[model samples]
Target: MMNEAIARNPQIQSMRYSLSSRFQAVLLGAALGEILGTQCQVMQSQQPQVKQPSQWTSLSRWGFSDSTLANRIAIAPAWGRVAVQLIKGLIRGGGGETSWINEVLDVLEIPFEQSNREPNSERNSSEQDEGSPLPDFPQIDAGLAIAALPIALFFHADPHQLEQELQQADKVWRHRPELSDGVLAISYALSLALREQLDPTQLIAEIVEELELNRDRPTTTDPSAPSNSANFVEQLRFTQSLNQTSLDRATAQIRDQLSKSQTGLDALTIAIAFHCFLNTPEDFCLSVIRAAQLHRNPQTTCLTAALSGAYNGISSIPLSWRSALSRGSSEHSPLNHLWGVATEAELQQLSDQLLAAWSGAYDLVHLLNYPGQTFAIAAPKVIRPH
Candidate 1:
């Protein structure tokens, strides 16, 4: 029965479905990003809303890194893994727990295992000093517990309960210092989505307020405005910055119309624009990409990463990007009895091939700004200390 359940898992099943071969093909395309993407962060903030998320955490998309929304769905998951690993690594290192963004790969190297270990670990720090490269996900219980929360939320026994927990977490996060920028972004996107179901009017109010703020408009001049100044209802919504008097009513209507949508990629479509506000504490550009995915938007990342991966580089794609370390044989596949996937070597080659073919941006703003276009920029920006 346990095996049956694991066999039925979506992500697990996905690896068995004919889709698995394509996944390798995609992975192959990604190799170019290892060298190409580091140059992407050089594209300075075209404006405030598009700025990279590594600065200060705020509701401003201007700070989003040049990571195109194309690859966000894929990147988000790795962030989930990395965030959990850091907390656990820190605890194991005797630093106890710190911010969610503390680097875990630096201090400890552990396999991504489900089993727990001793609280006061017997492992030596000398191992790190000896120069062993860190493994992807650390084998720490605290990290697993924290990392598992999002996964559980993704496939909760009761999504409503998880939503409630998320709401509570959001409130608690507002006052917590240890919370990372990625966590806050995840919280905000979740809040926006939850509000859509629980108190839709509140969502509208926020939308209206967000638009007004974007346009530098007085949300409500009337004295009868709701105590929550942001609760003002408006017929139009525009996230465009500064220029309220030029309210493009048609465009605002379109914005609201789009939000009402539940089509494929719509939520993530808006999410990429929304997540641009995130700011990670470390230089891990992948955290921001991961934050975009915590909301369950992977296809968005696939496309964006193909294009923007060249600029953003692999570092932005969390080190935990590989969900599976070794490509298990077909015996483990769901089709063990009926079919088989490519061998590990075949899969690796396919992964590299697919990555090399990826030419899409991971950031959505780029899509809005330039659709189906790829061009070289002036010399990429110089590196600065994190």
Candidate 2:
């Protein structure tokens, strides 16, 4: 059986190889989108015309935690930047414009090249986080979800299209012959779901239909095989036909678990589009859910529970990060110089806001998929320290 074979394959044994490569793709895409998203809308300006922090600090308006944003950008902006780059690459590859990513890059004064993709030949390359709790590789579902960047934000979208992307990603993973199917698919789910708002019930129905379809098929359906794509397309059509309330009921059950499992936004990132990037706060929760549903690992479930307990009163932006630029020197500051210098207190606040954004993103995802469901839950629970 392909499932059994895949599980035993030596290449799939380590998650490191797969996760790092995904970083290159997702970060590139996100960077491009962010640069374009920030163009006309008022968040913060690249440069100030006045002495007012209000004019210079557009991120303040969007509730950004400047200290945390700086730390994240410094620590692993490669993830976000790579995502932006990928979108630009995709655009250019398709013969579209590249100006969007370029604008953000120009303003931020960041690199035009992809940051994290270490050349395979270079022995120094690795997936390990620089002193963060998140794993270096896609060892867990939550971890994989985090590694997949913006896609995780889109999980609550229409499953038909998402599934296609997942399949394509899987195709690449399978060719590598070393990645976990459950791990990769979960990551694939998260990547597709990012930055897109959808109806929850619609998303749930589509997923349910997809599960049934996958359950009924051969593991290695050949692309060259007749009607393979056709059958997949039919599944999407079928899920869309479901009644609204039914879809909502199913989605509610899963969402409850997700809400319960959220611990913090330590893992979330600040996106140019607030909806696009979710840093890895307690990704292990979602990862565990994937492991359980897919029968992979039990910690995925435990992590989810742990995260839920930790996620009581989170704020998206840490106060210290928020204040770095909130009160600052009059000099024209280098982005890196201004981004640094955060107190522990500031980091905590930024963390809370990041969690809130993820929660908001999750809601939007469900809404986009299940256009018919009235699946409105209260806002994300925030956790603040004494």
Candidate 3:
């Protein structure tokens, strides 16, 4: 059972409505960013050559990638089951070696065979021949951070409890230490922003400092390994330094200085940089639009949008963007095709359920209306372009 005292904590109780709105913003912003980022990439790649000026055709299809899907799983009613499994495993003296990862995979209905496959195995022979060692397990995809967002919000009132939950969840992809750190940073930032109402500059500074402190802690998978937060901290600091500049210049500077790789520290850096560069969480549309134009990694944009949205809340997002997203074409509607439901309406419901779950008010009624099974059935195994 959830800690009743914490559920009724004064801070959380007072801010319930605000937190609910932020949760909705995080999920909705992630989906919208994915859509816009995908469209931007498609547009750039398909630009036609012509002697005379002509209007470039835009891709009509728009959908979110794996990041938003993982977020859906994170906030699904089924996640309560995983929480129970974690407690049981801990009680059985399993420590951090619990089967929480398998539970999440099962709840998401992702086949073990598929999840275990090496993400880089499909790379061309030339790339493989470069002598880069294959990861012991599949590298932690950046999308996994999306799964940690709700967990962060759930434990926002208690930083210690939040860290414990994050540590347990980090075990799911222990091989990628940097990725885990990145996820933790994003979650921690969101929690503080919601609780403290910190501005972007203060939020980024606080997050970097927290991560720096975490650098000395031993990892769950490897007690001897040093914390991997250094690179992320450095990147975040750089991102903060760019706050005074225009979004375009900051983005271009980030693109030039960072590796645009959609994995490990680079991807995390990109997302954080975008969030810091915007510094104006209220302008969700401009933030996501800038992110989409930053690079080809839609996941980065999605993550940035999620973070920004968490700070700004759902009402801060532009109505135009929300309306446009909800009206996505039949084949490309992420909510309908990828999530197996109407987008805006369902997100609102999920956001409420997540708040209810954290508040210890989750009941059978909410579960029946939005069953855990819907998450597994609706989410696609893979949505990112190769």
Candidate 4:
């Protein structure tokens, strides 16, 4: 019955009505995007070395085979797993701290010993192509963006806390200081979405400005290693300047320019993700489909979907995708055992609880003895929906 209610209205009316919807959208959207993107990546990897050019059309209608869907269920991406951990940590009152992030990583089975052996091992890996070969090390990758989702949503109302918390949480995975810029850029985008202030036309410029402002601050990246922030900012600006009407054409033009430059994969992933979202900011499915088919990097798709999801809310996502995810949950599913979520309903509950925590109403549900309660507390003097 409660699940049915959520299905009817996932955005439980609270002091901040749509805010609850955005919370669920960010988590579930990122997770669903991760799944779809991974499936596409797997399919792409299996393709023959030589590929043929395809028509300029959206592959949003691409069908996933049963085997592919089953495979996706078996192996959730590390970023998605970490994202779940981040959500859980926030609900538990954990905040921006290396110790707190490390504890979360430890629970997720990250091998700390490997990090010790490969402090400077910077190679493209599975979870993210942006940074080190070690899974534990921070790199300018999509995983960091996804992992920062919780902090971004939890502290969406406070820019200072948002930046500070993201910076601290990112410390657990050491990498080039540019990683901070990437994480902050993603978080800032989401924060804007949650605040209902995201302007797609001005997002790139705003992020570039934000990145430039933080450059003077001390960084965790090696000072000897030249900062990639400027280059990324330039790429983003170039991407934003394209006035093409067709996504395929724009993607081609942007990809051509990026190929001629020295932009790192981390930067490339973020740039493309932004491009896809900015192109179809109003259409979550279209934006995510383009990311999945074009970028082919799970992180790119994940980030794009997350941004779109936060902006559009859960209701904006395709009902088919939402239903499929809800049905995928099973008692023995790896998603349950590993991510601690057995169904879409559980994920929604987690989002509600996080909102409740953020609203200073952590005890509301318990106080009301409503284990299945979904509404989050809203502060006084805030607008409420009729």
**Ranking of models by TM-score:** 4, 3, 2, 1
RMSD of 3: 11.4
- Model 4 stretches with alpha carbons more than 4 Å out: 1-17, 47-58, 61-77, 94-100, 107-140, 169-174, 218-228, 243-245, 254-263, 327-340, 362-371, 379-381
Instruction: Report RMSD (Å) for each prediction in the order shown.
Output: 21.0, 21.0, 11.4, 8.5
Q: What is the C-alpha lDDT of each candidate?
A: 0.29, 0.29, 0.55, 0.67
lDDT of model 3 at residue 155? 69
Worst 10 residues of 2 by lDDT: 268-277
Candidate 3: the clashing residue pairs are: none
Q: Where in model 2 is the C-alpha error above 4 Å?
A: 1-63, 67-69, 72-77, 95-164, 171-198, 219-386
Candidate with better TM-score, 1 vs 4:
4
Error of 3 at 177 (Å): 1.5
Residue-level lDDT tens digits of model 2 in 183-205:
33343333333322222334434
Model 3 residue 108 CA deviation (Å) reads 7.5
Clashes of each: 64, 84, 0, 2
3 or 4, which is superior by lDDT?
4
Model 3: CA > 4 A from native: 1-17, 48-100, 103-135, 170-173, 224-226, 259-278, 328-332, 337-340, 365-367, 370-386
How far in Å is the alpha carbon of 94 misplaced in model 3? Answer: 20
Write model 1 residue lDDT over 192-301, tens digit each, in one string: 33122212224334544443443352322222222222211211123222113222342343346446643312323333322222222122344334323222222223
Structure candidate 4, residue pairs in collision: 138-173, 177-221
